[model samples]
Target: MNSVNNTDAAKPAAGLSINKRSRSWWSAPLREVLDLAFPPRCLLCEVIDYSSNSHSGSYCSECAEQLCPLPINRCLCCGAEIGLYSMSENGCTHCRHRNLRFESVTCLGMYEGPIRKAILAAKWSFSAVPIRSLGRLLATERREELQLLKVDRVIPIPQHWRQRVFRHFNPAWIIAEEIASALQVPCDAHLLYRQRQTRAQKRVPVSQRFGNQAEAFSLQDMHVVDGERILLVDDVLTTGATCSEATKLLRQNGARECHVAVLGRVLDSSA
Candidate 1:
């Protein structure tokens, strides 16, 4: 459902690129039609009135102002804060010891507040609206940071068949499509496939999270990613183990460099 090239999942609704649509002549009328049918409500606060929606298409301006952006001095590699980053002046300590595969990471914000609630809704509420709202926000806000990744293509972290079935929606894939669309880059939802199903990271210990995802992803076509600068997108990043394992294998298969873009990131301690 997440493949941008497939036209089944990645293809957004009839009205999309919500930000871009705001400028079009038909946008106002279309929005009025939707508001009448769907009755616009702020994605964050669930307010009925849309006065603040003029400032934020999906959320109220108050919640929008409260969105916590990632600090400026994050670890250039993992998108972690300076305190959590295992890095030094010379290089990253984790990379030196654990050998993480991705070269860098970027994200919209730390996992908290409305972002957290929206993510939970996406995962458990059986609704695509929250995902679409968050995806558009990410696309509108993070374009410059995504561009600085110097990526050749975008890929979502793959979900195992069972997980995909259980969840019914892949937020990672949805979010990746947003980033890809904004960057005008190719998005391959099937770039990586789950070789086997494993327990969700939440069910495993923090120390074992990395191992749980080890050997989990197999590239759909090795040659497609060989020597490519790939951007792996995910919903939330906590331990960084899952992305690390995927990166390691992708690079072994000849991916030149793998970077990550995530919607939300929770520190290991807090998570």
Candidate 2:
């Protein structure tokens, strides 16, 4: 991974930043003791044979290497794999006429294989873990790409009040805080609000996802994003209707630009 040079920025809340305790003088010895008490295991593959990396770091090298890059020929607009370049126009046929709203989108890779496995674990199995372990893992994995977006602030796609109560967490919010720290940009989790609970995009057909999310978001205040370049963070990018809707609100409220970063992107062959 590339080194980050940004100065430390104020955190969104406690436990959102990488646990600094891991860097403490007592941290190593404490982790060593814990390792002795219970043999270390790979968090992803669950192997018991592992050495000290970080107190929270648990993936083995083989698992880490599974995070491959997106296809070289991709839509410059949305990061979807569009096969080899077909023309001077950068975006794929589906997106050529549609305004994506965001300036650009960065994704770890196609939503399959190891990255997909990790995202499933993050969103479904382990919401209670501090920092959302899968999010912290992916955020650390994708830090370099995120820094290059050069956005002024980070905002997580907001969860409606009812969703948060049911899920007890927002994976995007946790991922946003982890990324905002590395980018050294302020993170504002409250910048957007979900006015209505929309149907999960995964449950709806790709053709209908855009309309499902169209009226769900509202900018908290016009003055908050006045002339700001914002980075909208989310767990995954499929049809991208979610981010586009949120970006539309932010842009309408005076955000100068909006870029997106997601843990994974689904390349829709069915579309």
Candidate 3:
């Protein structure tokens, strides 16, 4: 009994020693200063600052609740929200019209409201701080879907080299990294590559977006993707042109299966 008490007493000191030894040489002081200088704030609702409070990430509890996660009742192939008019097996008519290479797509949330503002704020406005919050929200929201897939690898939708250089950061990569961390999967940014830049899809006609993207991306290394079950990730899905082209490339390179996961999906007008 005395020996057990002594051992228990020593354990806390040992733990404290380990913690002291583990202090990061680079981040400890820097993070301390950062916290002191700029206290963390919620990206949405700006009401409850996160500096003093502890919630998972940037969004306040209110905004977090407001976020509408992608509904489970969606078209299996295209990830479109299914309505009363939709079919059960094949999903909506739009997916039927276009043959896609990936097995299916899972989106995290709706593109409107807070989710949209958060994505645009970080993606276009170049607010790096908000990325962590956005990523956390995405990871938390899609926990169930990610668990179901048991994804082997998380692949960020590749960006053309020039575009990556111009932007200085890739939005898709950030989101993919968060999801990968949450799911304990390998995040393979190099598995796929955008070999060349197509003209901007946003400025082009809908027909041209498909044509242009079909020629945009290519596989970087066949070995990385070949025979692997991949979860391709992107910030948003609009016409599905980009993901479709990427999926086609992965299939051609010998990937066993490709599944897409995005932060949001543009609602199909036809649906």
Name the candidate that leads on TM-score.
2
- Relative to the unseen true structure, what is the Cα RMSD of model 2? 5.7
Residues 54-132, candidate 1, lDDT per residue (tens digit)? 3333666666555545455677766655656345443343333455667777776767776777677766657766776
lDDT of 2 at 231: 90
Best by lDDT: 1
Candidate 1 wrong stretches, greater than 4 Å: 1-38, 51-57, 68-71, 83-97
| Candidates in descending lDDT order | 1, 2, 3
- TM-score winner between 2 and 3, please give it: 2
Per-model TM values vs. the true structure: 0.81, 0.81, 0.80
Overall lDDT per candidate, in order of appearance: 0.75, 0.73, 0.71
Q: Candidate 2: minimum summed lDDT over ten consecutive residues — where?
A: 1-10
Taking every candidate in turn, the Cα RMSD to the unseen true structure, in Å, is: 5.2, 5.7, 8.4
Q: Clashing residue pairs, candidate 2? A: none
Worst 10 residues of 3 by lDDT: 1-10
lDDT of 3 by residue, 1-271 (tens): 0011222345664567666577667666877676668665676666646443433346667776776553657778877777756664664765676666777888765577777777778787565556655765777787887778876788888788878787857878877877877887878887678778888766777666678897677665776677878888888877788888988887787778888888777754411
**Which residue pairs of candidate 3 clash?**
none
